[model samples]
Target: MKKILEIIRYEYVTQVRRKGFWIGIFSIPIMIILSSGISVLAMFIGTDRTPVGYVDHSGVLASPVLPEPDGLFGESMEFIAYTDPAVARQALLDGAIQGYFVIAENYQQSGMVEYFTPDLSYDMVIGDFEDLMRHNLLQAYPETVRTRFEQGSNITVRALESTQQLNLDQWWNLVLPLVIAFLLFILIQVGGSYILQAMVTEKENRMMEILITAVTPTELMVGKTIGNLGVALTMLLVWGLCGGAVLLFLPAYALTQVSINWGVQVIAIVLFLETLIMMACLMLMAGVMATDAREAGQLTWFFGLVMSLPFIVITSVIFDPDGPMSTIMSLFPFTAFFVMPVRMTFTQVPGWQVALSIVLLAGMIALAVWLATRAMKQGMLSFSRKIKYSDLLKQRRAA
Candidate 1:
């Protein structure tokens, strides 16, 4: 136990102290901050709020100019009415106006309005203009009708089981699952690769033989796995802290819209832990089976691809969480850790299904660890050649 702890400590400290680890830990948040900064800068710096001309052919809209309105992103819009389309076109050509909207003579009946702009990319400008036109149009109606139109419909989406109404604007329900799955996918791919590389390095340097002399195979495996897991968890903690910090900047209403189902979150954590264990075991086994890093990389590529399948099919799971394909993916051990958590996020998953999945995953993890340990012991001395999968199976049968 002492030896195992020592190994764990050594591995953990060595990794945590590395510049590459710290850089990786900070990279995501830094990139997010930089990107956000660039977006804000672009929003303010390059965008000009030039006056927009409008031609209201409808005789009812007699006002020569509409009131200036503030845009969603703080840009001011000035609407100037024109008597003729030719004048508005001339103003646009002369750069006196950014764009123009022409309300047809039959606008009251046909509701046809045409907007001309040089920049199609200014979608927000068009959207804001549309909203302004909508408001102006609504003013023609009675107060009661205008109020009802402005208030829109009261849509209440209730769950069949609990009869609890869900908020349509709760964007977190759509976003959180994908975020969690993406995080898990990144951790598994990166951490598993690190474990594979570390094991290959140890084997290449003949350090495994020296280490095995001091500790049992199981102790070494457990220590190494725990150490690497600690590193992965540290990265997760850093990212979590950064995410929390970002949430602080969000509006109260936005924050309120983020509802967390603790049951689902707890299950997600469990699935992630199971995934890490399984990946670590497989990485160790891959390392044992290979004679060098090249061989290790080649062997582990298939496992990496298989692990990424969940991420590949995340869209399908998001759209139909309780679909047949999703259920199959959630129940399958290889894809369960990613798919199940995502599925749980979008819909209510049955307790029996969750339990069965957990049991199957736990069983597979135990089997993987056992196989990894057996392979390590058998192939530890056979460094001159690669270990065959059949040999490992035969050794298991003999044991």
Candidate 2:
């Protein structure tokens, strides 16, 4: 136990001293700022500036059907009274108007209209205009008449549901889940890669042999894995600090409007720490199987992909947080780290599930650490070109 603690301390120190740790700590805020800035810039660039001319041939003048114009952010419409449909079509052909609106002789009865745009942008504009026109037409009718029209239309709402009250400061609930998933994905991938590389580096350079002579093989392996975990924790801390600072102090748009509870923040921090510990155990298991840097490199992506799969399936887990399948995933050591957080975020996670997940995770970590130690003690001693899992298993069986 003392030796293990010593190894942990050594690993933690070595990881914190590395250039990668420092680089990661500082780069995250820079990347976040740059990404946000680019998104805002794109929104501005995509906004329309051109004015559209509408030739209302059937007396449907620009009432509330036209979208409100806001300079470059919106499209303005000009209404030109046309004596005949022929004149409107001619005007559209001559580029006298961006698009021409033709209402049939009995447009009120036909309930159909045609619009022609010079380009696709105008096509969108025409579609939006049609939507607005339909909205205004229905709204103009009596409530009973509008209800009848809606019943006849058979329109069903999809994707959009209940409207949320605007509490701008509470935007964390909206962005936090996505950002948390992204952070977890990144930590697992990058931290696992560090373990693989470090293991490979020690093996290829024959440093493990020298270290094992003074300390137990388990100590060396456990130390390295702990060191990697330390790096992961440090990264999470930096990202959390950056995010928390931005949330509390920066007051940027949607973020500014929401109030954040420190208690919630503390819970998130604890959960994140638990996740990192679980990830460290898994990384140790993978590192034990890795013979060289190349093999470790190959396995890094594999483990990352496995950890990442749960983040992709978060919505499914949320819809049924305690369903049979979700229960299985939540209990599964490989998936629990990612799945548990997502489930907790989107749904009301039951106490049993949380307790069971943590208990199962703890058991898995203890078992994995034991297996990793046994594997490393057997495998790390072999000064051969290739390490075999069969040899490690044989040693463990004999022991």
Error of 2 at 27 (Å): 5.1
Per-residue lDDT over 1-399 for candidate 2, one digit per residue giving the tens place of the 0 to 100 score: 677778777767777888877887678768878898888778577644344444454455545454345444454545555666677677778877666666665666775666766665535456545645565567667877855664454332222332212233344554665576577667766676666666666766777778778777767766777777777777877887877787677547756455343433454454455656656655555555667766655544655666667667776786776677677776666677667665555455566777777777677667767766765765564445444556657877898
Compared with the true structure, all predictions reach lDDT values of 0.80, 0.63
Report the error of model 2 at residue 22, Å. Answer: 4.6
Runs with alpha carbons beyond 4 Å of true place in candidate 2: 1-40, 57-98, 103-111, 119-123, 126-172, 218-222, 248-271, 299-301, 318-322
- Estimate the TM-score for candidate 1: 0.89
Model 1 residue pairs with clashes: none
lDDT of 1 by residue, 28-108 (tens): 668867997999888777666788878988754564323245544655577778988999999999999988989889987
Best by lDDT: 1
Question: Model 1, poorest ten-residue lDDT window?
Answer: 63-72
Pairs in clash, predicted candidate 2: 168-257, 168-258, 169-257, 169-258, 170-258
> Lowest-lDDT window of 10 residues in candidate 2?
157-166
